[model samples]
Target chain A: MPRLRIQIRDLSKTFREGGREVPAVSRVSLDILDKEFVALVGPSGCGKSTILNMIGGLIAPSAGQMLIDGAPVRDVPRQVGYVFQKDTVFPWRTVTRNIALGLEYRGVTGPEQGRRVGEAIRLAGLAGFEEAFPATLSGGMRQRVALMRTLIVEPEILLMDEPFGALDTHTKLNLHAELLALWEAKHQTVVFVTHDLSEAITLADRIVVLTRRPGRVKMIHEVKLPRPRDVIKLRESDEYAQQYSQIWHVLGEEFAGHAV
Target chain B: MSEKLKINFWRLAILVVGVGAWEWLTGIKAVSKIPGLYFIDPFFISRPSKIVERFFYLNSDEVRLTLWQMLLSTVESTIIGFLVGVSTGFAAGLVLGRNDRLARIFEPYIIAFNSLPRIALVPLVTMIFGFGLLAKVVLAWLIVFFIVFFNTFQGARGVDPDLIHSARFLGATEGQIMRTVIIPSALAWTFASLTPSISFALIGVVIGEFIGGESGGGIGYLIIASLGTLNSADMMVALIVLAITGIVMALGIKQVEMRLLRWRPEYQQR
Candidate 1:
């Protein structure tokens, strides 16, 4: 078994606005092993993104602790990378320059940065548009650039907060495949956040569903689908249907809570 | 291509017709025999041909210094003022933008200074700086500083917070974020603010020269001298030159902006 890469213990976050406290996450704890692909799925406003933000060190936990590789996160750690839900690629930088941002920040040598940027650009299907600005590229292409930028830094843990949430269906499907291939190859501890349950099932090895607001772990489903599973084709398989319903059964109660 | 050519042709035609009508109306020798048929006095209105003729004569002669010298003086003041104003304003905006407390502390004073009629301060500035290069430069700087400062401040504040967060996770230090992200973002706003500052810088120089104290000769001074001597053609000639100078200066700034901001998608079209 791989060693634990991320450990969250008694984690809770309460936001104070105008002196009124609003809790976002309460005592939500999870242990993600090295090379594990975990998908956090919940209804909207469920603090899934808030959890990811804490892991990435973009925000602090109001209580408890978030540890990466056994060390508590005090600030943004260099070993962690994040892909935001929104287009976070700097529009002023060219595609190649955008991908090389992290490497440049780390003070990697010029030639090394260029080589890594070239490889990541090829991996992300951004080979030809190296000099194009983000504004000129399509939404999908910019997101690919964003992914390449995060990956080029080679962080040990990747925390993606609904990175493909804004893409069209066709683009989303293509990106899902691309992301899976990249994750499988790198085997980095990946924690992806999504509101779509089927998406969580299609991509993750273990799906952790959370309840609606003040999100807490509701259930965890271990997907038994074989390796190199085709997302769309796997949907028709008996095991896929069984696991989907099994997870949906647990999620149904969470959705009901959302109405009240 | 034909549509573009037609537009250009119409623009030229309008200019020609307008100038021709003005010349006809103000024709001194041509209307002298018509006996009270004059709608305009040539001595006051000044025909375009007479102005051009006056331009050539002044170009060769020195009436309160040569036309070239006066233009050079005005250009020098505008350039000095622009450089000082833009650099100081951009630097101050960058510093205060990151420090919210300092920005808040200074906000009221900035607003008060910006609201004052800048032209009304010419007498005070001339008294302090003594109607020299410094006076004109100070006046031009005052005209440009507030416009660029406000835009730079807004631009720095408006930088996408998500991008900053991403950069921080990417291991960018505070200085790195400021250099690669905040500064470039503010540069766009600074450039937008610069377009108007170019005209205002020139206005400041002209206004300073028109006030006329010690460091006495510029295009503005020539216009003032011409008006004083009732030489309407000289005044018109100087005004035309000033207009041309303003256009040329604006075009020069545009060229620099285009070259520097080629990374921009919208500007890439040109």
Candidate 2:
């Protein structure tokens, strides 16, 4: 196995709301290898987003440790990038300016900053809407801007929390294809949090199934599918069906426990 | 008709109808002497036509300085007060807002100062600053400062945590985040407080003039002089000018707001 790019050791998070302790995650240990796309799949309220937030150093893990590239993740490190479910693009900034924010904040100026922003915008298929504000853009287009905003910084690890959960199926599919194409080219380590099994199967190299609520890792499934596979075509295959049924079975057990 | 025209038409109608009714009831002596009818005497309320005529007359020369000169003096003080008040308040708010410990330490003092009857301090300010244009400007600044300070404090404190987190993850330092994220986010709130604060500045200047410089300085001075001799028409003329000034200032603020906040999406109700 490749040297682990990200290592989470018995990670957990608990929130205090209204003077009560609400446990969110429970002793979730995992290893994500370099250049691997790992999909974190679970039922709603399974702390999927919480894990991603912890990994991104947006929130501190209550009772565990996180190591990225053999170093402890103490704060929001420059090597880590996060894409939120909601559009985090500044409404006041135009597409080009918004995408350039990371580089700008890092003190990259002049022609080099412009070149990087331009390249990311082009990759995200947002070339013509460079000057458009977030308000003027469609939901899909705005999310693209959000993605480009993070991608332009050239982070080694990208942590996404249900990045396309709000999009329609057609838009979601298009983004999935676009993301996969980009990921295939760059081969950065990605940890994607999602509830959709199909989305997990479509993008991830290995799927990590998490149990509900005080979430813990239930199982890990390797894709076994070849690289450069077409998303639409892969779903039609027998392997995809078998993999889907198996993951759904494990997820249903968590749902059954949750229902009680 | 278009929305703008329709709104303008209604506004004009309201002004005409309201003033016409006032003119008929109080301005015309014949209307007041109608059998079995008691009406407000024109001497008390004054006629719109007489007020307008008095306004023109005063503009030419009713005192040592023309109405225009007095108006210019009042505007100067108000503008100075507004600029000084807004800048200081915004700076203080941003500093206090970013530092929770500092905000807590000074909260009581700020509240105490804000709660004190500011108008009552006019006499004290007049005594210290000598009833001049400086006194009026100081009073205007004092009144406007608290209003803007409170709004800006809230605005800076209320910046969305998500945005801050996003900015931090994108490699912004504390100083960079303050400039690029916090300040811009606070701008909408700062602007929201502007209109009321500006009006307060005008009120402060007028009150200062009314209390001290009653001879030949401002519209408030003219009003006081008119009231001394019970010249209701002259008083009304001064009031009309004040009203026009207020409306014009409000419109100017709205234009500035629109220009600065062009990025905000306009939401329409269906």
Candidate 3:
């Protein structure tokens, strides 16, 4: 097992809306290992993005502890990269410039920055799109640019918040394969938040299911599928069926919730 | 033969036909003096060729103070006003935009202040700053600032929450996000602000000329003196000058906007 150890204790977030405090994420706890592609599966508005934000150190946790690489984080640490659900490429720059922005921000010096940017563009399967503007690129390609923008910084962990929820299934599958291949090579600690169970199952080494509003972890299921399992073959595998049954059983109950 | 040339020829033809009708109507005594035409007067509301004669004399130092000097005065005031207004507006807007709480408290007050006709301030600025180039520049600045400030403020604040969330997730510091995300978003709007702002800035200098005078041969001064003496031909010449100046400034700003916003959605759509 890779030593990409992660620990979170009593994580919570609350926001004031319409003069009332609304809980977003409630006292959630999880410890994920190094190079563990953890899929946070939940219904929409279940605070999966909130959890990802906390991990990325974009938003401070209202209460609780989170440790990545055995260190407590107060803010965005250099060791983390984030891919947003929507395209956030700078509209003033070409796609190539957008991808190279992180290197520029981190003060990565010349020649090397260009080379790494070129490599990342290729890695994200954004070849021949280096000069195109974000507006000119298709939705899938723009998201690819967004992913490569994060990849250029070469962070140890990646926090992806439903990065493909906007793309159609066909585009999503292509990107999924690209992402899997990229991860196989880099082996960074990845925490992906998604409502789509198929996406979660296809990508995750371990899937952590969360309950509805004010989300709390309900179950964590591990995958025993072989390395680099073809995503298309997932539905056919009995192991896939077993995993789906396991996740679905946990989800259907929590989805019904401990309701009145 | 080409589409562009065909459009251009039609526009030119429209101008010629309109002027011809104006000349015939005024010659026939069918129009009023308030709106002069080509045949209105020999010395006062003279024909287009006569106004063009005055415009040609714009090249002479004695008759028109030379074309270069008129251009220099207008260019200097325009540049100073634009720089002061745009920079101040951008800085204020960017800073205030981040503090939504503070912005909300002050927004109504800012809007009210902008609503008060700014032309009223020309006299106030001339009194406070004195009737010099500073007064003109200040007048121009006042005219240009509010439009730019409001547009920039909205642009910066209206950044999609998702983008900021993404930036924060990607290890961007607040300062980095402002420089990278907030400013770029605001710039597209700021460039738009320049069109109206340039027009306002020109009017400011003209207003300053009305109050203090660009001393001599200024377009505003020429228009006023021509009106006072009822030299309608010279007034037409000054009006033409003013229109040309406005077009040049507007076109210049549009060029800059095009250069800056080459990646905007409109650019791709076009």
Candidate 4:
């Protein structure tokens, strides 16, 4: 068995707004093994992002404990990288500069930094647009820049919060293929948060479905899909449909009684 | 004709008609002598031809050097005040913007100072600095500092928190984030304030010179001297020169702004 990379026990977070306590996530416990791709899916306002934020050490949990590699996470871990839902690519910087940001921040310079940035740009399929600004690029291209920026750092744990949630079906499929290819090479532990049930099934080794607001783990289903999967063709398979409906059955229940 | 040429033609036509009407009413004695036309006196509103004649007289070899000297003094003070104000304001904005405690402590004082009509302090500035180039520079600096400071502070404060979070996750220290993320984000707001602040700096320096009167040598001093002698044409000439200077400076700054903000969509369209 793979070693457990992340251990969460009785983790909970409650936010206070307007002098009233607003619970976002209740007591939740789970363990993620090394090299596992775990997807967290739930209805909107279900604290799915809050969980991811806590795991990435972006925000402090109001209660409970989290351990990464047997050590408590008191601050943003050095081995973790995060891709936000919004396009966080700096508009003022070019594609090359944006991808080179992390390396520059770490004081990496000279030919080594150039080689790494060039490789990342090529990997993201952004050749011939190295000097282009973010404002000129399409939404999908900008998101790819954001992804390549995080991926170039080569973090041990990649925390993506609905990274492709904003793209259309065609762009989303293309990104899924690129992401899977990159992951197959690195095999880093990925904790993805999305509301799309089919996306969770396509990418994750395990899918954890959560309840509505003040979210708690409702169900955790292990995906038995084969390796070297084609994101588009795999969706048409019998097992894909079986897993989709089973997770959707649990996920759909949380969406009921809420306005569409 | 193209749209641009058509607009330029209309602009020229309007200027010609306006100046011709002014000259017809005041420059020609016959038109002034007409019934009810005497109210348009050259004494109050100088004729365009007389002002142009005064402009040429000032530009002549005898007085041209003095006129250029005064113009240079005012321009120098305006440029110095702008640079000093922008640099200091940008530094203060970044410092206070990153530190909430510092911002909270200084917020009330900043608002109180900004609320006052800064022009009213021109006389006080003259009294303290003694009606020299120093006083003019100080006045201009005071006017520009607050404009740039407020915009930059708002820009820094309004940076997307997600960007900061992403930077932190990428192993950026606080200093690196400020240098790479906060400064670049605030730059858009800082650049937005530049045109207005530079204009205000010119206004501040002129106001200082106006209060200084004979003690200072600038276009504002020339205007005051013309007013003292009751030479309406000379006053109008100075006013016209000031207007032209302001327009040219604004256009120059706009060009620089476009070049710097080429990354912006608005600039990219052009």
Candidates ranked by lDDT, best first? Answer: 4, 1, 2, 3
Candidate 1: tens digits of C-alpha lDDT, residues A201-241:
88899998988889898888898888786767877888888
lDDT (C-alpha) at residue B45 in model 3: 56
What residue runs in model 4 are displaced by over 4 Å at the alpha carbon? A257-260, B30-39
List, residue by residue over B1-270, the lDDT tens digit for candidate 2: 999999999999998999899888774455545753337677777888888888788888555677888788888888899889998999998889888999999999999998999998999998898777888999999988888888889989998887888888789999988988899888778888889888889999999889766542888888888889899998888888888887888788877877777667862111
Off by over 4 Å in 3: A1-4, A254-260, B1-9, B28-45, B61-68, B99-112, B214-217
Candidate 2 residue A194 Cα shift, in angstroms, is: 1.1
lDDT digits (tens) for residues B151-189 of candidate 3? 899888888877776666566678988888889888887
Instruction: Name the best candidate (by DockQ).
Output: 4
Query: Candidate 1 lDDT (Cα, whole model)?
Result: 0.88
CAPRI class of candidate 2: medium
DockQ-wise, the better of 2 and 3 is: 2
User: Model 1 Cα displacement at A253 (Å)?
Assistant: 2.7
Instruction: Give per-residue CA lDDT, model 3, range A76-113, as digits (tens).
Output: 77788888886777767887788888887777868998
Question: What are the per-residue Cα lDDT tens digits for candidate 2 across A217-248?
Answer: 99999988888978889889999999899998
When summed lDDT is taken over every stretch of 10 residues in candidate 1 chain B, the lowest stretch is B28-37
